[model samples]
Target chain A: MEQKTAIEAFAALAQETRLGVFRLLVQAGPDGLTAGDIAAHIGVPASTLSHHLGILERAGLLRSWRVQRQIYYATDYEGTRRLLAFLMEDCCRGLPELCGTALSDLVACCPKPTVDA
Target chain B: MEQKTAIEAFAALAQETRLGVFRLLVQAGPDGLTAGDIAAHIGVPASTLSHHLGILERAGLLRSWRVQRQIYYATDYEGTRRLLAFLMEDCCRGLPELCGTALSDLVACCPKPTVDA
Candidate 1:
């Protein structure tokens, strides 16, 4: 992803409500949660949730799809991965040597790359 | 780190100049770079560079220290790790079988954990 894209994604996540919403959608998986369900889960007014969701969508951190009458919002894994890749691009290239400490911490937090990866 | 800290860090990184400054510091490694050098490398005015540096420092993404007449700025690895950990906390816990795709992408971008890890 370009740095501008990365910046927008970061800005979208910088707010508490949006971050909570993103994590909730991430936990809810790729199928995501319907707007009503998300609002109920987050205990926010419909208007507030709508605003945050719009910001996330504009930033490309979340994607929404319509199934019947319901609109479900989920974390855009591709966009999310792109942002993650952008941030770690420089350090990971150096591998286990130069960025050792940070790299180790990152590895511990990140999962193993499966064959599909 | 608390969500507030993470928010601050993300906010600091949301801007182009600050993110450039941060990546420069990260690439510069733990030894960091002097304020003057950072300004020179980033090609920003002294005042603009200083302002951006202060924001990064306050947000806990960067740390500065005085060595003789120079003030060196470096990525605060622990603080950075905290933000990264916060972002990945929920998904990583679900492991390979769950948050799979995003996790795999993360792993591909991250390094392997050392024995000490």
Candidate 2:
């Protein structure tokens, strides 16, 4: 998590279209989405979406693979974790208690739905 | 958690100096640091650092308050959480088991230093 790398990751998500794409991919999960599907869901032209995807992949926030002729993209969880670790490195400086709970909640992720009786 | 807001936060941290400043404040913890200290530590001039600080504060990544004559900046944990929540929102879309553990590691900050004989 070098400073330069972190900045690149931040820059990758700084745009509205790119941010939306990343979120969509995150929600899409391990299965990921093909570039065409992503472009369609995001209501952007394929050409435009391709550029954004390239930026994200270069920033290490995304990973892509080809299935036959279609290229799929998924959120790079390891890259994401690295970015988060860099942001929170040395947090509270040996006193995790000061920021642990609040920060930990960030990772709580999708809460389970409750059923009605 | 709005798309625009998330973009703003990402943009705020995309720059080198700003990222350094934010990391410094995160390390500084709740006590924060004065603008002067931040500039000195980051090796940037007061005027330049002031501009970056203003951007980060507006994006909600950092919070600033005045004490007597000096202004202090600290990482806004609430804001950080919000940004992270947005990033991981619907993460795995109800399948927390898919991403929970990995994401949870993000909050495992500030590991205690080991003691040796």
Candidate 3:
């Protein structure tokens, strides 16, 4: 990803409302959530959430489709992953060996929960 | 990291000049870069680089110290990692099992280049 695109993704996710919306959509999985559902969970007016969703889609962080006159939004996994890669690329200097420990440290921070329990 | 802190970090990195400076600093490794050297490499005046550097430091992406009457800056591993974690936390829902594939996919994108080459 180019610097400009990475910056746009960061800027898009930087807002509180936008961040919340993105998180909700991510958890909702590939099927995503309807626009109305997002607005309700976010506790914001439809217009307000719509504005945030527009920013997210523009940033390539989200993709939406109309199903029965209702908009369903889902996290753009590829786009989201691209942004994460962009952020980590510099940190690792694109050299995994050199940054092995650092990468390991970050992974450790993400402990797998006991989902099977 | 809070939304405010994330926004500040995003804003600091959103600028072209600042983004360049940050990547240079990150590549410079934990030792960071001297103010004068960064200014020279970035092809910016000392004042301009200083301004960009100030924003980076304030955003917690960097940490600097005075050594022998000169300031040296380096990427703050902890601070940087915190911001990354914040971005991923929601996507993973704090449940690694749910995001296992997504997490793996992102790691693959970081394919460790052959530093041995």
Q: What TM-score do all the candidates reach, one by one?
A: 0.85, 0.88, 0.80
- Indicate the worst ten consecutive residues by lDDT in candidate 2 chain B: B108-117
Candidate 2 wrong stretches, greater than 4 Å: A107-117, B107-117
Which of 1 and 3 is ahead in TM-score?
Answer: 1
* Residue B3 of model 2, lDDT score: 89
User: What global local distance difference test value does model 2 have?
Assistant: 0.80
Question: Sorted on lDDT, highest at the top, how do the candidates line up?
Answer: 2, 1, 3
Better of 2 and 3 by lDDT: 2
Best by DockQ: 2
- Give all candidates' CA lDDT scores: 0.74, 0.80, 0.71
Compared to the true structure, candidate 2 yields what TM-score?
0.88
Tell me the TM-score that candidate 3 gets on chain A alone: 0.81
Ten residues in sequence with the least summed lDDT for candidate 2 chain A: A108-117
Sorted into a CAPRI-style docking class, model 2 comes out as acceptable
Clashes of each: 0, 0, 0
Summarize candidate 3's per-residue lDDT along A1-117 as a digit string, tens digits.
788887888778877899888867766667789999999998999988999999999999999999998999988877877676555554534444544354444532122211110
